[model samples]
Target chain A: MQIVFLLEQVVNGLVLGGYYLLIALGLSLIFSVGGIVNLSHGAFYALGAYVFVQLSGTLGFTAAVAVSPIVVALLGILFERFILRRFYNEDPILSLLVTFGLALVAEQAIRMIWGAAPLPATLPSEIRGSVIVGNMLFSKYRLLMLLVIAVALGGIWLLLNRTSFGRVVRAGIQDPDMVAALGIRLQPYLTTVVMLGVGLAALGGAMFAPITTVHPAMGSEILTIAFVVVIIGGLGSFWGVVLAAVLVGVTRGVTIYFAPAASEASMYVLMFLVLLLRPRGLLGESIAKFES
Target chain B: MKTYQTSRLAGQKSVLTRRTALKLAGGTFAASTLGAPALVRAQTGPIRIGHLTPMTGFLGTLGGWAVEGAQLAAKEINAAGGAAGRQIELMSEDSINPENGATKAQRMLERDGVDFLLGEISSATSLAISEVAARNEKLFVAVGPRSDVLRGERCSRYMFCTDIPNTAMVNAVGTSLKQDGMVDGKKFFTLTADYVFGHDLLAAAKSFFDANNAELIGDELIATDVTDFSPFILKVRQANPDVVCLNLAGNQVTNFVKQYAEFGLPYPMVGFNLNTADAWAAGVGNLSGTWPTVWLDSVETPESQAFVERFKAEYGKIPENHAWISYIAVQIVAKAIEETGSAATPELIDYLESGAKFDIMKARQAYFRPEDHQLIQEAYAFTVKDEGTYDDVYSMLQLDGAVPAPDAPLESIYPSVEGGACKF
Candidate 1:
């Protein structure tokens, strides 16, 4: 009801959107280049959080945050090279099933290592308080997360638009066969894209670790929302994922403000409306275009 | 089986136990499962106890611990020569949800021919299994899920809950809140888990609010599977209540509390249904506020000390509340069998109804209330430690320092059950 209340929600919404965007982009990227939708992307995220907790004991929080996601990204690369790579040329449904199975395996694996109970992720002393902006207050840690994620996403945008590898990835997403036919060794580049995408998911997990705590099912928990982001953002559209994740997160935040009961449903409602109006998502081209 | 009736106290929400849907479903399922008489009618045959717990889901690990406790108890019971002068056989099946619990319970009853059922932590799962218990005319000692409806609205003669029910858990906190000057006339907001348990917890909190004339600033039902609490926490900030009543459940509670601190909310955390496992899950410095616990590893009672030591010796760690409930559940059921000199469902029910008190590894003697079958025992109000351990749980809070909660006399902890939904 108050202006400050609305302002706070909006700010929190943006921060959450950035958080979700970090995870969604990776899911979208894997789908675009590898022709595989890695449901285990969330597993990568969970692994990242656990890795940070495990490594932080020895490596310290700062170093753990940097190293954890890379470990998960490498884990992702291993899956892609040996397991997921086998499904790239197969049916998309098969890829979905395989990744889903992998998600289960990853969840159980985390459970085995970390135990079933949720483990707390300690807040680094750096971002433990709230900062005032204008008349409203917001979580400083979330704001920090937003800033870091924005930088990462911005760099991703540059890599996609301003770099040579980005061009090939775009082309591969658009036409993997044609890109492969161009004699431009697409396999290694695709692997890089998968690592990039999976790495970001791990980074999102690491960034959120302090807030959400480390748990085995957390990856699956966020994966559902990421899938929503992927579908709503347009599977292969880079900017589409970014904008849509923010939209979903913001809408959810704002919905909670107005109608707490419907907050969970608000994101899906947005997705439904988007699909009704723009079948390929807010900025995604077309499903047929990607398939061909 | 006896049914319980409870009325309001100090303007609190009366925890109506009538779960009509579950009662009907259970009643019908019980009817369908009747007439399976593959039992080895010999009194000396191995007594089978089927454990329907959340074996493979979010609560899977706790479920595993629950079954482990049962195994330990069964081992001890058999070592002393099984209940009713027979060996005890333990069988476990995953009871992730009500539907699964019902189906698996049927499997245990029909195929496995379990003489007794030790069931679920989730209220819904318990309700589902209760239905099968009623249908099959079997005795089920419900250990998890703290829904009072088990003895109230959908009271079944076949089910006896061993753990603290939601009302008692809430009332323990409510009693403290009223005393600590947090409830009366204070504005509060609630973020409850979206399920029967959450609704029940909210009703309990509302009772405290009503008694003390507190204003409910706002309340929200969070879905069971939802991990994100920012949206709800943001709303809590906007409401600016004096306290945030966390009626959330399981891992969601951990997620919500950690995020609450991360966001740096200043409101004092209070309200009902906080558990030891949830606290351990959050780890050090993450847990704030005092909570009501049915069992703690730090209990100084000789019985509790011995149980803790033995449990640790056997399981390599301290037992969380669920694990405690599971172990004691077997002891209670086995003791009933010992007292009645039979493992027959009706006889055990009758013996428990007769106020057959059992030692629950606590200072107090727990007995099933004839009306609701809710075990009557002393529940503790516990504060978290920066670091501690009991059994396998490395981060449990200190038990030596626990404040015996409700600080009210034992009788006031629960008012006499009358006019409740249960009609047996």
Candidate 2:
């Protein structure tokens, strides 16, 4: 009932929201440009976490964090080249099924390698303690996580808005054929976009490793939450994801404080309300024009 | 007259040959009898014990520990020349899921040809494999699936459980709560995980509470994979019960305890047998002063001490109840094999059914009661004390008495099972 306690819960909610956004952003990018629901996005996230742990244990956490995204991006390229390339002209459901199967294979492969036990990942010594804000204390790592996510979001925003590559990506999202007619190779651009999306997912996984136990099935668990976030934010809108992430985060935090029993149900309720109000989502374009 | 006399003489000659042959056979048989014991010994071969464990799934860590305990037991038994002068060989396979469990059981039965089947951590998986044992007529010694169904309804004449059932621990905690007057007209709030094991424990605890005049105020069942428990805690605060009973295990318990403290609920929390020493050492500090029912604690006896010392020396950590239960399970199997003088499944079942008393770490003479095939042993009422400089959490109380096994009575508690559905 106390304001301070409520504020602390809200802070906790923001940290969770940050994770949702990290996952949702990648999903949104793939959906808008690649026109596919990559269910295996979560698999990439899991790969990122596992790779982070393996590399961090040897190369240290800092170095692994720096290099893991690039490594994951390369994997993304391979995946797009060998798998997604064939599905470009296939039915959307076909792509979804492919990703779903890929998710299962990835989960089983991870299980075969790492077994099923959760590997504990601790925050570095410098950031492990709590920071007092008024009467409430929040984990310093959470605060740092929020800051890192903000920076990443800002950098992504700039990448989408300011660069020539951003214009080409936006064009591809609108119409891949027109972009191809403009003499830009569509395959390489799609591959780059896929790499960026997967890299972001990997980055999110790596950052999340210290707080949560890293395990093979963690990706599937988080993937469901990410889908909820994406649906609430709008299918493939960049700003919509950011705004929806924060909204969902705050809602979850406040709900937990007031009525903890309804926390999980609250997100579903929000998504339902959003669909009822705007079928295409809060910031997504109306579907009537696209249908024609 | 000459022809008839010649025929009689031939018949007499044949009779004499038959008698000589009988005498020669008797002398040869007497000589071969002296060598029969050695030939029998050579034919019996080493006792092969099959362990089906979950080595790659959600419960894999616990399964790994169970495998370790079984391996240790086999090593010790083999070093002592095994049961009845035969070496022990353990053949293990991964039972990753319920279907996998049945497959693994079949493999152990038809392919590997093991003398006995051991290891099951999940109750549902155990129930699945119990059918395999029932059909195949293999003696299945369950290690840690504490569901009463394994012994009550799904009980096979060939199946014997080594771990304490949920009802035993629930009753132990329930009785302890009654003694402390904690259940006298107190409102009870339950936040149980939604599963068979969780529901069974909650149902048993509720019956005990109701019998002791406790009021059931509120109850909620959360999904097993729900990470955020704040909503449930908020509901608990709103319901405002005097006592809250948690029926969660493993990481869920740890997460619940941490979140409960954060939510600042004022009710005294009591967990029904799900809390263990390893869980406490991991992160039950948030519930520092709470009491939970336990089977084995380190402060109990010299046997427990020696087991803990040996486990720590080998694995570089204290053995939790999972490891201890698993260790005891293997020992019980070995004891049955030794007593029966044969590793045959039928003979092993007979040995277990004989109701012979055996020494475990806590009990002086623990034995499986034939009526239900439940282990009749002492139960512990453990209170989690502050982290010791040396010991992780000191036990505040130890209760020693014969707690009735799971099949004592289900008529008043679970009507569906008691209504001839789960009859032995």
Candidate 3:
């Protein structure tokens, strides 16, 4: 019976990890290709939730969820062109500070527009409630969300592996200078990567608005965990983030089962242990540019 | 935002830059006003008050409303005629957390030269500010924190609490639960906020459970920053308690409520502590539980309804309980200053402890208990209305009339002397 309960927690943690993957994968992708941390990635996620909430009031849930990510992805073009483009080849600290500042500005801007209150967003009626499988209980909406996330992960994997665009983006992540020397213009690839990265984050936000508090500072809260997952996964490795997200999620759940107070702290402990043993991360390949 | 002026003449030379002069002025104020009698310091000029609350965090939304309430009170007081014939000048800053809260409170006293301190939503931060006020021997009216510890063993001579304490909140909801036959022989699972506030609430809830013969089968102490509750929810399911009790605060309540609805658990839910902002954020259909609140906009009183109208007109949204508490705190302070003819700490404290009652836009006038300095006032319990009954989030809660009944004593629901633990 105790084992069954622990197993149930593991399964629930995996579902949570899938949600974390939605935000962290985008963060890792942006870092891998552009060498920018994109601190404002969470801002796009927050905007996605806000937009979904606003639109869902008028257009209903399905249409709002469909349109919110596209809207945020379009904003990614302007973000890459105006702000992110300048610090690409500069000191990493410059981009970090600028994006950090932008994150604060984005939060304040959200407060000014939407007020400093959490907006109420509800799951569609059909998707409300839970499904019981033998001894395990699962939220129906979360199951649907897990399916959506799997499809998204699949789509993203194919886009990165089997396309001409994928080849350029991969090359750009390895050596931008060599890619430019080959007349490949890595600039366009960077913008597309940022758009896709932030769009995925926004989709995470839209999907989660119903379950979490959609307020201004939510971006910063999710951003911290996203950074944790990215660090554990190592920079520039897609599969590394996927693995780290699941590990962090499962660790948190199992920790809660035994020692509930340390549930949130378990991820940091995992990160510390991982960094102690494998500094470059589980699947992180050595990138020459960042080593310097 | 009060600017202190220092006029220094060194042989007819005034060469300090504007910024440097201001800095020098702050230094001089700190030096000269360190131990001056409050009567001497507060006799002239504006009644400077420092307002510290979290402007960005889990409690930020309630703090936003708190600022508006205090601002409206200050504006109305100044417009009508300022407190004690002096303009009530406010210097507001964000009390981010406990360490920062103490630092800001120290700065407000030493550099800003505030006569009194007010406003806080987090009990941890409020406890920090109370310690600073005690060290300085300045009056601090804690307007929003509901932690019983603030009025208990941690209580200070120089601090007063305005919000309903945790014991009272448990009693408020416990009364309703008892009437509905939900108390006896019930097994309870609680998800508590893991901080001073949440711990204090859990203690009060344990007492309520013990007194009512209810059993606590399982409990989880959740961190204040946790936004996820699925793992904890699964634990609740495994425990399979008869009632799901929440001892959460701020955004934690809304997050848990929304997710609990998503999970669609079988157990009925109830909470000992809930702010109106958290309830509104959970929206209409997501939140379905009996919760205790200090005050709500739907309270049937002309003054309460008028204040709600004014708040809606100003902010384009209905006022939450934090706003009401802050607004009435300023009014209470103003009334004290006006009646005492002094803003001196000792005089104001004496007048407040004299058992003077003030209208807090409620049926019964509220007064501070001399033992704990907690305001004795009516609290109410609310249950979410059925789906389709409320058109908007603000209208979703069906607020019960004041607890302890109109004929019952207001302090009947409050923590007893042994439980409150105040020495002074």
Best by TM-score: 3
**Best candidate, DockQ-wise?**
3
**Candidate 1: residue A207 lDDT (0-100):** 80
Q: Which has the better TM-score: candidate 1, or candidate 2?
A: 1
Question: DockQ of every model listed?
Answer: 0.40, 0.06, 0.50
In order, the Cα lDDT scores of the candidates are: 0.78, 0.71, 0.90
Tens-digit lDDT string for candidate 1 (A31-106): 8778787888898888888888888879887899899988988877788788877888776777877788888988
Over B1-424, each residue of candidate 3 has an lDDT whose tens digit, in order, gives 1222222321233456678767887987777677566546567778999999998888887888899999999999999889878999878789999999999999998767798899899999998999999899999999999988888889999999999999999999999999999999999999999999999999999998999999999989999889999999999999999999999988999999999999999899999988888888987689887999999999999999999998888888889898899999999999999999888799989999999999999999999999999999999999999878879887899987799898899989998765557986
Runs off by more than 4 Å, candidate 1: A287-292, B1-38, B41-44, B56-61, B385-409
Sort candidate 2 into its docking category: incorrect
Per-model TM values vs. the true structure: 0.90, 0.70, 0.95
Over 4 Å off, model 2? A1-19, A30-155, A162-165, A172-216, A224-235, A239-292, B1-46, B55-58, B175-182, B261-266, B275-300, B312-316, B385-423
Chain B TM-score of every predicted model: 0.86, 0.80, 0.91
Worst-scoring 10-residue span by lDDT in model 3 chain A: A283-292
Q: Which 10-residue window of candidate 2 chain B scores lowest in summed lDDT?
A: B409-418
Per-candidate RMSD, Å:
9.6, 15.7, 5.0
Candidate 3 root-mean-square deviation in Å: 5.0
Task: Give the C-alpha lDDT of model 3.
Answer: 0.90
